[model samples]
Target: MGTINDGNTHPGATLPWGMASALPHTKDFREKANGPAYYNFGDEKIYGFGNVNLSGLGCPVAGAVPLKLSTGKFDWDIENFASTYKDEEAYAGYYKVTLEKHQLVAEMTATTRSTIYNFTPQNDDKQPINLFLDLGANTSHRKGGSLKVVSPQLITGSQLDGAFCGFQKSTNIYFALEINQPNPQVKIYENQKVTDKREVKGDKAGVVWTLDQLDQGKLEVRVGISFVSEKNALDNLRKEQGDLSFEGIHQKAIAEWNKQLQKVDIETSSNDDEQIFYTALYHSLLLPHVISDVNGEYYSREIDKVLVADDYTRYSTYSLWDTYRTLHPLLALLYPKEQRDMVVTMLEMYKEWGWLPKWELFGYDTFVMVGDPAVPVISDTYLKGITDFDTELAIEAMLATAANTKKNPTRPGISQYIEHGYIPIDDRGGDPQKFSWTNGIVWGPVSTTLEYNLADYNIAQLANVLGKNELAKEYYRRSDSYKKLYDPKTTFFRPKLKNGNWMESFNPTDRFFDIRWEGSGGKGFVEGNAWQYNFFVPHAMNDLKSLMGEEVFLSKLNDLFSNGEYDLTNEPDITYPYLFNYVKGHEKKTQQLVREKGDLHFTNTPSGIPGNDDAGTLSAWLVFSQLGFFPDAPGIPTYQLTTPKFEKATIHLDDYVYNGQTIEIIKTGENDRYFNQFTIDGKVREEVYQLSHQELVSTNELVFNTVSERLSEVKE
Candidate 1:
């Protein structure tokens, strides 16, 4: 659907999702979609408690209890006015504020190994009231955990019984404390697993839970968490705050964050960019939430794991190879029923772990980072139909984990990266696999095996659109082994050798940060590099512009989007500045290089994010370039348009869907890139118009003109 009859001749920027505008903090029902402790599920408020011991397992002693955040200044700048704190509170655990002149309380419990925080001061009465701990805040290594001050009158009640907190892998975590006092017993000792340059003496110890004896009124505390024993920390305090109190377990954790922020219903008028886009979509739905409870159960405690005892939903520390590109494709477009319960939690972690997770946390998969990137974010969210699972057992567990990570030759550097295209530099792929952090990332040093052959050619085009045509022609012949490590005399996409020759001092501007090895170890690789991943083989950008032509691939795609040294901060340079909308007339230079890279590379604060946002995969490329259309080529379903950040947008997919969309961005301001003119849904139409994905989930009407002078006239 395209159109235009205004003459200036640029009918290239397509975007129509009209009459939809709501998300301005869904109209202050406690305003939050951003700012104020980051993810404010519209403040129905439930600070934190991932698995405060419901026994379904999951607890490094998580807790963030701040519900209303004092209402305004974007909720006291989420602590910074109180002065600084968003380093994602240790994977979002520990945080408590009850001040009015200090009634403060903090508790982070664990101890299957380490991590313990217990700060209590009811009235400051007898005076010893200073308890503020950040301890390497948001972590860069405080290693384990500890803080003490116990003695509710020389400690009684069985010396504070079976204490608790949680977390074990990625260098353990634990915590414990007990007090029912008035106020006045102080001790502050934090041990990040010691070793302050070898002088180990008991490295550092704690558990002295004292606030003197403040009992000025109702000062009770007894938190718990455990892997097993300390009687599972009084059975996770009788399955979560038994006999509630602590404001009824912090109002049942703000009614479980208002039932996961009432699923989604935003409106928007700019209440501070809808509180930073709904608190970054509420910190992107609290880490693959529900790590298991409601009896599906959980508990893994890492190290050559086993024992994941589940019920149904068990998503642990899933960095899902960087939040399955664009935080699970915006949770399959605004939670399509939790994207069909996260593809039934990835076919229940490939039926209790046999191979699926490429970076799991907690219940251990920690194969940590790098492609196998959960197969192009679970096969482009089950081929955009967001399946309700068992889609032929999720395509035979992604064709048995991409044919066992491509025929496992003791996978680790994965069978010389599917029989050599690039991995070897000796020691079977040299020094810590060229340091994807000492053997973690096997490929992805600019052209991460072309993002693993374009996510194995979109998981073999979603196994031939679900029919599985012989496992989609054997993964489209292992996705055209990237034309056997293409070199065509250094056109780029290096690393090959084994007599093929290319590796030695190959410096494509040493984009690999430190010795060209890929993905983030090459800091700017997995996120960006080699001039934004050699214009990301966009399924071979026109066979790489016929070996560099069309005026040297449009001046190397306009200096890779106006070279201020491009790093739109991750996701292989997110469609590298909309690769001038697939070349042809250059669609008004892809709508003026996406509004000049969202106005000289974005800005809204907290370092207005730029790199390592691999969580919402760079905010799903700003929700598909603010909805103009751009899915360059993820197993080719269809999408390609430019310019859209809302002038009108309506997308209400529940209750028998309704799309009433609209986007009126025709700002040609004429600088010239591409787009001539035409019309559709009204018929004036022209060429180059790929839209599919069921005409973008059933469309309605779309319009655009924006040519600001440049029409020598050429209509067929």
Candidate 2:
């Protein structure tokens, strides 16, 4: 659990979808192998403040352009530059830290495009105040950067860096920094040595400004960042923060967070539970960031050029492999307008790049994880009634990727899968030995096959809705390819060679990273063992249960947990616990598993999350689980019911989807975790295990009665 509970998340300050995040960085801990913005609760040194970050990614990227303040003689050594800090605090939109060594208190808040820093130096040191612009300290390996002192109070720069997930590419970030007071002297440095130039351009370039006076010992700085250019960065700064006070900007950010957080409110007896729920919600909205500038200008890696948005705000950083499971569905439920715009952004990306994004970061296709995930995301959004995007173009994009055979970068190994029912492990001629490009050769064939089949199922649903009968039939046939790998002898999804025979060697428990993809491997699965991948067929679970037989399926499901085969840390097996809802007389087991796992995995501490939130995928899972139901299938509009964790919970659905309707769920029991039955609008439901999306939103209230034991039947 310790390995999975690393909680590779930063306790930072940022808006709900803000591009800029402010994090407290520890200089000494920088050598450790932590994620992008590492802030452990045990570390004490405050090296500097990071201005940009990407949350939950195992590889280091983003977190570019750090800023540190010092009084007296400037020291470039890492050991001398850090200050021991205490009294650290962080909330949804704000972070505060006290640098005890320097007697300085640093507080930060953020807007969508810019960040505000308020620093107050307590000691009356006669030494001059110096500010260091660390251009080289990016999370990604820095290639080169340039810093130019625009004026006594302003500086502008850009850093070129990349290698996200070890994919060799270049990403650049242009930034503008503004100080409230003017400074007389500014010096430039390259590679840690001071230079006499006003501007420097090269690797590890930085600038330092010596403040004439601290203006009553208070220094305020505002930073704006842009993917396009420095001009846009300054434009964003002026438009968002403008001459506003630090308190004003902080208050506005808080108000925005409150507005979004109020969408779902719960009544709980413990403060820890409330914090865990709201904080999980806060983490869930951090990414799929707002990439477009204030003037609707953005950098498009798909075209390798600059582009402009007409009416919608463009977004980037789609961790689709992890997010398509839970985060996007959660968005469709709570933030329908935003989800529609996100789908529009995906369609536009296809128009610009030739294919949809797999694991995108900073406008580049990272190819980080497996699967054709965008299929389920768009299909789920359309089925949920957020159909404001171009449906025809979206369908074309889905088909283009689905039928691709020439080693397309987006849908790797589609050609092989089309020829044979499953992706053969021996079809590894074009597999990438290095993670440099997105040429789309199948790396993990077994996992890719299962994921593509699931995606095909979702695409078939969309095709059926659009009246494309032949296309729907073809995709529906392809969606059943998962059965080809099923071996009744073992009742598991086994890997096969191209010669229509199972691999000679077999070990369902073996797991490792024999390939570039993360997680266990060796038996043809990606990041999971055969035991976990056995239940990958979420679209046709009933058929799977029939194939495995009800008694065997139930026993295996229970053994998965008791024998420690169930992995809650990863996404592939997160839904395994909920499959019991599909079996009659076993729904109570679903409630028991959901409640037990929720308590064991999530907490209120900094290291609370079970795994890399994976761009809020795990957090969204917790959110949905706590809400008393889960969107068990991505493209389906139904939710599998479970027992609520709270006494009362309310969800304020987006007006665009449900006419601003609010669904309140009330649970009545005395410490009882089993579900007895449920009623909607005073009418009892025949099937208490599931609820359709229409039924959930159209009604006003839902009441769940509980007892010490599970009820055999519903009573009117």
Candidate 3:
């Protein structure tokens, strides 16, 4: 269709050495619009969304059907011509499609590393190919340039030596199609000023040859991708293909999906939801990509201002602030082995870099967001009973990072939080700064307070569990440090002055700026203001109620839910929806809010995320809600229940259940997303929430019911 190859000067791509026999797979069994239902063969999963660009879903057209090349390649014409086959019960990562226009049979395979598409065109009018390589189809950091075309015949005869650089400047990546047979009539189509082609039959494709042809239909093109240079792309093509045809590789990829889909048996009547969930889960696991040398050596710039030996794979591009809540937790549960390895990697990173990372990017610990969320990630793993490593060493490293470093972008507020119980609206360390003028300072004090408190609570709980009483006591005391920030006068924790005087003109919602890191939303705190931050004291909810009084706490909770202001589209109020679980007789509200928030906020789109997916934050909420539970706090070993989306689902843990029991949740007649009661194996329970990881691991069957409460009765 369309061909653009700069020139052949670069060396060949290297083969991927980390290849494992562990095939790629998925638990989802639903089908979608375009491709075969879904296929996870080896390291890939394929979805068929005929013409819709679901940002980052990585549609399955790459392998089966050649990329559609056009003059203005920015727009995809596939949308006008076809629709992906949509079936609900189809298994994960496997899809079969019959093209609407050409009736071409196509199936796709998606894995962690590769995508394969197989198409059999029936009425071939010269296959009328539209293969376009839009070099700009990548992340924001990508730079496009020309690619080299090296086949067996061209590489040996011409004898070009050095690296044949790409046509466009700054084009760091390249592609080469390992074809089945040498076609005589190969010419670069629609290319201006560059029309060239050479045959390479027996010898392997090397850098000496030039890529200047658009073979529309004659030969089958094997398209392999890599982040490394073109030489490596060729190298990968050789190692992966060698003598195997493109169809051979496609078949191998399909087999990989079949194996992984066999992991968990999903038995749901609604095939559509099941398909969406499994594919969503599959896409969720695809990113935070690994960019490294062929030998798997990645760039590591630990906090020590020096390079260190990076033995374990270093993953980058995570939004930890959002992911820490649910994504990380979900990984620890479903993929424990992967989770353990990731934890080990974090520990090694801590050793190399002094502080544990909050948000680690490529070779740099870019602390983009507030919160020592690393604590929760590790602690959630430990509390959820996935402790397989050196717990003491992990804690030691965690403590060092939290204690050794005190300041970040919002250090002023964090330091004050550690020193004065609450961050003061007025400057205590020095003269008032510009940000001190804002109101967000009301919530700005939360980052360190919550971080240290959670770290302390987790470490203490872990220490006591591990028989280290002294360490436990020390951390337990540290956990209580939040008491210093609680102001009794307003019945709400407010920022204080250096001399413990309340700041003048203290309106929680009035002032806008905060001196805290990034001003959260204005200066007092992170993305949310006081209304959202008030419910953050996860362990001290009872204490918070004591200050506001039961009536006030209930009223505040009521106001938060009804006030369109408590947006579920953001992360600040994540725990707020579940606060009703803390209040006695208010469990129904918790159920209603959790389901509403879960259902309304999630959509399959580029804008699906209200905030950063942050590595799995939103996914975690889905997994927990669907399972009928969520961890309210890190160290606190309990989960609150929301209405479940499924009637029954089985969670597979490594070693928790004696043949895991089926968790069944019954929905109320009114489509209102709230719950009325919970049952342990059909017996009604007193509490409104579900079991935490600890409880779930230790307990048996769980079932839940819900009812809608009248506004009058709710107040009463």
Highest-TM-score candidate: 2
Q: Candidate 2: deviation at residue 426, Å?
A: 1.2
Tens digit of per-residue lDDT, candidate 2, span 114-162? 8989888776765677778877666666556887778878988887768
lDDT-better candidate, 1 vs 2: 2
Can you give the lDDT of residue 705 in candidate 2?
A: 83
TM-score of decoy 2: 0.96
User: What is residue 383's positional error in candidate 3, in angstroms?
Assistant: 1.7
Q: What lDDT score is found at residue 8 in candidate 2?
A: 65
Of candidate 2, the 10-residue stretch with the lowest lDDT total is 27-36
- Candidate 1 similarity to native, TM-score: 0.31
Output the worst ten-in-a-row residue range by lDDT, candidate 1: 13-22
Rank ordering of all candidates by TM-score, starting from the highest: 2, 3, 1
Worst 10 residues of 3 by lDDT: 1-10
**Total backbone collisions, model 1:** 74
lDDT of each: 0.44, 0.82, 0.47
